[model samples]
Target: MNKIYILLGTNLGDRFQQLNLARKQLETHVGAIIEASSIYETAAWGVEDQPAFLNQVVLVTSELQPLACLNLTQHIEQELGRIRFKKWGERVIDIDLLYFNQEIIDLPSLQIPHPYIAERRFTLEPLVEIAPGYIHPVYKKNNVYLLDKCTDDLPVKKISDDEPYRH
Candidate 1:
């Protein structure tokens, strides 16, 4: 089984609930979720006018290939009422394939070690929590290095008093 890292976020209704639903669906479609990072509340990226998002990273072991995983993630997003109206627009849920066993891929439908992995602090912060030493195949940098290089100044705070999916 290949270990894959997936990042999930939500800014719409019951954000925490949406994230939990995504995680549950992912476990069914993909494989066992080996690790999960603490949830972080962050300002929306790209579509900066939207609401802040609740984000988290999950490390999973799966038998599916990268494309398959991507497809599965999209399915879950759609099921959770995600609508791709604008780039990074607020949504019910967003699931992104962040990395797949240090593999480099650039295809029309998918990219491993997601192209924007180094640019988003929301993604990197949780990634550092779960897999700080995992290397990025293309950049050859670990999570720590990537976090250090990220230029996004969006604040990320861990909700210490809340449960993973409790709103």
Candidate 2:
């Protein structure tokens, strides 16, 4: 089995339900979910005019290879009502493959370690919550360190566990 980190974000529709449905589909298609970070609410990244986004990171153990993981994630996004009308546009759900067993891959279709890991507060905040000491393969710095050094000034507030979907 391979351990992979995935980021789930949603800003359209019932955000909580979208996340819950995405998680269920991911577990069914990707693998068993081992760890998940608390949900976070943050201003829209890249495009600021859209609704605030709810984001979370999950660690899963999967038998699928890296590319297969990417394909399934995209499929899940589409099934959940994602339409790629514009870059960084609002979506019902977004699933991103962040890390795949600490391996670095640079294919046109995918890039492991997610090229933007260190640059986005939304990604780093949840990463620090779940895997603070996990090292970035290319940056050689742990998640906590990357989060501290992250220059993205966006505020990432962790949602209270009082939510119905706290997973």
Candidate 3:
């Protein structure tokens, strides 16, 4: 099984419910979830005028290749009511393939070790929680190290006692 790390976020309409549904969809289309980070409440990135987002990082062990995983993630996003409008626009659900094992890929449509992984606090915070020691192939740094150096000042608060959507 290939280890994949996925970052999930939602800012529109029942954010927690959206996240839960996304997780369920991931399990169905991707692979069994090995681990999941706590849900984090954070300010919007890129498009700052919208509502804050609830975000989390999930680790999955799958047999699918990177491109196949990407396609599946897009399908799940669309199924969850995502409509593309702007770069980083608010949506019902957004799922990004953050990393796939230690593969370093750069293609027209996909980039593993996600190009922006080091820049966003929301991604790093949850990523660190689950995979603190996992090293970035390009940066040669661990998630904890990257999180420490991250300049984005977005506040990420973990929500306790909250459950993700089941279906």
The lDDT of model 1 is 0.88
Let me know the TM-score candidate 1 reaches against the reference structure: 0.94
List where candidate 1 sits over 4 angstroms from the true fold: 160-167
CA-lDDT, candidates in order: 0.88, 0.91, 0.91
**Which residue pairs clash within candidate 2?**
none
How much lDDT does candidate 3 score?
Answer: 0.91
Over 1-167, each residue of candidate 2 has an lDDT whose tens digit, in order, gives 99999999999999999999999999999999888888999889998899999999999999999999999999999999999988888999999999999899999999998999999999999888889999999999999999999999988999945543332
Q: Could you tell which candidate, 1 or 3, scores higher by lDDT?
A: 3
Clashes of each: 0, 0, 1
Q: After best superposition, candidate 2 residue 93: deviation in angstroms?
A: 0.5
Q: Point to the candidate with the largest lDDT.
A: 2
Ranking under TM-score, best-scoring first? 2, 3, 1
Name the lDDT value of residue 111 in candidate 1.
79
Give the best candidate by TM-score: 2
Q: What are the root-mean-square deviations of the candidates from the true structure over C-alphas?
A: 2.4, 1.6, 2.1
Per-residue lDDT of candidate 1, residues 1-167 (tens digit): 99989999999999888988998999899988888889999999888998999999998899999988888989989988999998889899999998898788989888786889899999999899889999888887798998998899989888732443321
lDDT score, candidate 2: 0.91
